[model samples]
Target chain A: MAERKRRRALLRMGAGISKSARVADRLFLPVVAGAALLTMLLTVFHRQIQEIVSPSPQPSGEQQGPRADVVAYTVDKVPISDPDSPVWDNIPHSRISLADQSIIKPLKLNVPAEPVKVKAAHDGEWIGFLLEWPDSKADTQAIKVKEFRDACAVMITSYPSPPEARFMGTANNPATILHWKADWQIDIEEGFQDLEKAFPNVSVDMYPLLKESIRDGKPPKTVDIPEFARVRLPGTWAGNPVSQLSKASPVEKIVAKGPATITTLPTQDAAGWGRWRDGVWRVVLAKKMKASDGQAGEMVIERGQTYSVAFTVWFGDGGDRGSRKNPSMLHTLYVE
Target chain B: MPKVYNWQIGREMDYWYEESRPRRQAAAVFDTNKCIACQTCTVACKTTWTSGKGQEYMYWNNVETKPWGSYPMGWDVNILKMLGPQRWSLEGERYVYRGKTIFEAAAQSERVLGYLPSDLDYAYPNRGEDETNEIVVEEKFYLRMPHDLWFFYLPRICNHCTYPACLASCPRLSIYKRPEDGIVLVDQARCRGYRECVQACPYKKVFYNHVTRISEKCVLCYPAVEKGIWPRCMRTCIGKIRMFGYLNTPEKADPENPLDFLVHVKKVGLPLLPQLGLEPNIYYIPPIHVGNINFLRMLFGPGVDQAIQTYNKAIAGRDLELVAALLLNVSTDRIMTKFKVIGSSEVAGYDENGHEVVRIPLKEPAVVRPFYDERLQVYRHNIT
Candidate 1:
C-alpha cells in the first residue's frame, strides 16, 4: 500500500510538470509575433515617434545648452578677419551638405551635394565664421562678359525667431547675408580690375568725357581711369554696387525677402577675407555682435541665443551666379 | 508652359508666360534689296546710344554680308545648328511650323533652348565681311541673272519680338516689354548679370557689358519713340531701306497702313526666322537676286516666293500701291501712320494726328546740258 501511494505521487508530479510545459509552448509564438510587430512599427515611424515624445527642443522657458551643428566657442580674441589664422587650429569643424537651389523659377539639376567644413568663434564684441570648401578652379575676376566669379555667403536671420529658411526668407522674416565674393576679395587686395586687365591686347583710341593731362599738346593714347568717364558708364553713374570700381569692404551686407529681392544695406558693418589654395577656398566672414549706431538690416548676435543660419556657394568654373548656386539647409547656430 | 498665339507661325505655340499683346507693337520693315550697307545707321546708333566705355564692341545695329558674316561670328548658323532640322508645313495658305521652337525645345531646368557665346565670339564681329557664297573661278567669271557667286548685306537689330525670349529667360524678370509700346528693355536697376538673356536671344542682340557687369540691348530709342520720332538707326538709314511704324494683327490689317500694305496686302515683307516662334516684329523684303530657294526659305519663311513675286511686281510697275509704300520708307522722322499715293506722281505720308508729314515725287526732274558752252570753248562732258 505504501509503494502504490508513492507511484501515484510520482505520476501527479510528472503530469503537473507536463501541463506547465504545454502552457509555455502555447504562449511562445504569439508573444514573439507581438514583439516583432512592435519592432517593425517602431523602425518605420521612429522619427515621428521621437517628435511626439520630445516636441521640437526649441527652448521655450529656460536657457538651453548648446544643441546645434556649430558652437561658437568664446575666445578672448576671435580671429575675426583672418581665414588662415592659427587660432582656428583648436576649434572643431562641422561638415554641412550643400544641395542645388531648386525651389524657384531657375532650377539647377543633376548636381551632387557638395560638403563644406565650417567653424565658428566669437569674442565678447564680435562673431566670425570660417568656411572651407573644395573647388578645382579659383575664379577671381568678373571682368569678362562670359566669366563669373566664385562666391560664398552666410545668411543669419535678422530676428532671433527662426523663420522658414528658403527663398532667403519670406516677406515677414528677413535674412541678413554677409556675401564674400572672390572677385571682390581680389578687388580689395589688388587695385580695381579694368578693361585692359581683362583683355590685355585690347586698345582704345579715346573715350568721351575722360579727364586728360595733355602731354606736349596731345592727350595720352590710352586712359585707364574709368571714374573720370563715369558719365559714359551708365551702370557706374547710376550707383550700381556691382559696377563700383572701389569697394570699402570685400564683404557686402545685404537683406533679402525672397529671390531677386536682395538689397544692399546702406551701413555695411561686415568684413571678410577669402583665400584659394590647392583647389580649396577658405573664407572668414566677421561682423559686430551688437548693433552699433542703429544700423538697419544688421543681424544682431546675442549671447545664450540660438539663431538659424544657412550657407550658399557658387562655383564660377561651373557658371554659377546669382540664383545658380549650391545651398545648404537651415542649421542651428548657438552662441555660448 | 502656356500656349500663346504666334501670328507669324499662324498657330498657338509654347511660351513661358500668358498671351499678352501690347496695345501698339513697335515694328519695322527693312528692304534688303535697296540696302547699300553704308553702316551709317550703325554709326548713328553707336553715337546716340551705345557709346559708353563697356559698349565699345556692342553694336545695336549691324549690317553683315549674308551666307558668311555675323556680328558674333555665326550667331545665326550656331543657333540653327542647335535647332537641328526644323520644317514648316503649309496648311491652306498660312504655314504652320511643324518643328519645336526654342521655347518648346528647352530642357526642364531651362526656360529657353540657348547657348552662351564666349568672349572671343564677340571679338570678331566682321568675321566674314564681304565674303561671297562661292569662289569666282577664272573659267566661269561671267555674271548671270542670279549671279553665280552671289552675296547680300543683311542688316540686323533687336527685333523686339511680340514674345521676347530674353524677357522669358530672365530669372529676375529684369527684361520687360512695355505695354504702351512693344519695345523690349533690360532694366538697368534690376539686372544681376545672369547672362540668360544673352544666351536666350536667338539673334544674339543682347550684349554683356564687362565693366558694368550687366547685360544691355537695343532700347529702340524709347525716349525718341515716345516723342513720335523714329529710332536713330532708322532715321539715319542712308539707303532709306527701313520703315518704322506700329503693326496691327493680321485680322486687323489695314490696307492704307504702309506696313500692312507691304506685309499683309502685298505679302512683300516677311519675318526673319518666323519658325523660331518669337513673332519678331521686324520684317525683311527678301533679296530677289538670290536664286537659292532653300536659303531664302530658311532665312525668311515659306512666304519667300510670294514675297519675291510681289516685290518683283511692284518693281515692274504692276503694283503701284506697293511702290508708293516702299517710296515712303524713312521719308520723315515722324512715325508715319497713314500714306496716300497722290495723283500717281507723289507719295504723301501722314503722322499720328493725320498731319501730312512728308510728300515725295515718284520721279526726280532731270536736267540736260548743251553739247558746248556759248562763251567757253570747252565741249560739254556728255549731254544727258
Candidate 2:
C-alpha cells in the first residue's frame, strides 16, 4: 500500500510539471508573435521613415528634359527680322554684275563696227551704211569703236534713226564688213564721189555695171583675167657666138639647121654616106682586112661630122584632135 | 526513281547549325558629333589596306564637306540627281523600288539593273563662264551667309550591307556577304572590272582602280577584326571619336565600346538609304545644332528627331535598361542594371532568387572632345 501511494505521488508530480510547461509555452508563444509583428511593422515603415527624414532632391531644370544639356544656346531667341539680330543679310543683286565684269575683263574682245552705204538696183528709203575693212599685214584691218560709231551716226543722219545693219564679218581673220539689207538703194558713183571727197586717202570703188550684172545673174560676155593667173613660156631659142661660148656664155651654140633630107649613092665603101629613103638617113661601111692574112681594114666614120639635110616636111595645124607624129608639107628646102 | 542522296545534301546536313547563337546581327555606330575630321583614320586605312598600286586616287575612307563637297569631284550631287527624289512603298513585308522588287522581274520581263550615271557625265567645278584653268582655287571662300556659314565633314565608307546591292548586281557573282559576321566583300580573283558594282552601289563607294584592272572597295578590315583588333581607321583616329568592337562581344571590350551603345536598344541608327534594303551595318549619330529646323530636316530627313533622341540617350545615362532589354531579349529585372547608367560601380549583391544586383554612383561629368577644334592644325606624314 505504501509503494502504490509513492507511485501516485510521482504521477501527480509529473502532471504538475507538464501543466507548468504548457503554461510557459502559451506565454512564450504570445511574446514571440508580438515580437515578429513588431519587426514586420518596423520593416514596412523603414522606407517611409527614411523618406520623411532624408532631404528631397534638388529640382534639376536640365533633368526635366530627355537628357541633361551638353551644348548651350546663347542667342536662341534672336529673331531674323530684328536689325540687331545676328542673322546674315541677303546678297545684293549688284554683286552679280561685279562678278560678271570680273569674268569678262580678262579676255581682250572688241565690239562690232557699224554699217556703210552701197548702191542697189531698187529705189527706197535708206536703211544704214555698210563698213568694209581690207585685210593687211599691219593692224589696219582693225575697226576702231569711234570709227564704227561715226559710221553708224552718218548712216542714221542720212536715213531714219532706227535703221538695221547686217554685219558680215570675215572668217579668215580680223577683217569686218557691215552691210545694209533694206529697200533703199544708194547711187554707186555719187556715194563713191562723196566718200572720196570726205576721205581722199581711202581706196574706195563703185562696182561697175558689168560687175553688177554678173552679180545679179548671168556672167559677163568677156572674162577678165584674174590678177592671180599664170603666164605661158616662150617657144623660140637663141644662140651665142663661138668666142662667147668659150667665155662661158649662158646661151647654147647652134651647129646647123635644115629640113632633114639626104642625097647620096649606095656604095660598098665603109666611110661613104648612103641614100635617104622612107624618111630615114642611111650609111655604108667596108670591112677592114688583117695584115697577116692580107685582108682589108674595117671602114669607120670620122668624128664631128656635120650633116646638112633638107626635105618638104609635112606639118599639121596641131588642133585639139591633131597629133605631132605626122607633119604636112608647107614648103621644101635644099641643102648643099 | 529511288531517293538518291547527293554529296552536297550530305555536306549541308553535316554543317553544324549553332542553335545557341543569336540570330540578330550587331552593327557599328559612328557618333558624327564627336568626329574631328583629323584624317588619322584615313591615313591609317590607306597604309594598311590601300597601299598597293592603282589605289593612288582611291580614298576607301574619306571625310567630305557638305553643300559643295565630294570625293572624285561631285559624287553625291551627281548620284542624287541621277536617282531623282526617293519614293517608297511597303508591299506586304518587303520594300519595293518603283513598284517592283527583284522577284517582280518575272512579271515585267525586263532585266532592270539599278540606276547609273552616263559614262561622260561628271561633276565639274564652276568655271565662272570665264575662268581659264580647270582648277579654280579660292581659299576659305563662303558661299552662304557669313556668320551662319557652317559646314560639317561627313566621313564615308562602304556600309557592308545585309542584302548588298553590289553582290546582287555583279554578273560574275563575285561579291558576297559573310553569314557569320555579315561583312560584305568581293573576291579579287573573280572581279572582272565590269564596273557594274560601281554603277550599282547607291553610295558609290565601290570604285574601279585603273592600274589594278579590278573593282576595289572597303573590306571592313576582316583580318584586324579576326585578331580582336580594331580597323586601322578606328585604331589610329586622333580624336578618339571612332569606336570599334564586336556588336555581340562588347562585354569583353573596354575604353571606347562601340557595341555598348550600338547593339544596345536606345542608340541604334543607320546611314541614309537603309530603305535600299542593303541592311547596312554602318550607323551615323546625327549632330544636333541650333540651326534652321528645315535645313536639318532637309539634310537628315524626317527621322532626324528620332536619331537625335537615340543619340542623346546614348551619350547620357538614360534608356540604359532599354539597351539591355533589347540585347538580352528579356524584361528588365528589379536588380538588373541598365547599360546606359553603368558608370564606375561594380556588381554588388544577389537577390533571394539569385539574380545579380549592381551598385552605381552619380559621378562627376567628363569632358567630351568637340568634333573640330578651332586651333586644330592638320599635318601630312608619310610612311615609307
Worst window of 10 by summed lDDT in candidate 2 chain B:
B8-17
Tens-digit per-residue lDDT, B41-136, candidate 1: 899988887877678889999999898888788888888898899988988867889998999988787889888888878888777777778786
Per-residue error at A115 for model 1, in Å? Answer: 0.8
What are the lDDT figures for the candidates, one per model?
0.82, 0.34
Put down candidate 2 lDDT per residue, B105-210, tens digits, no spaces.
2112111124333322222322122222123345523354211444455667787754455765664456776766666777664553445566567666776543
Backbone Cα, N, C clashes tallied per candidate: 0, 23
Model 2 ranges with Cα > 4 A deviation:
A1-336, B1-26, B87-149, B246-264, B290-301, B310-384
Give candidate 1 misplaced runs (Cα > 4 Å): A1-65, A110-114, A158-164, A211-228, A290-298, B138-140, B368-379, B382-384
TM-score of each model, paired residue for residue: 0.86, 0.37
Against the true structure, candidate 1 has what lDDT? 0.82
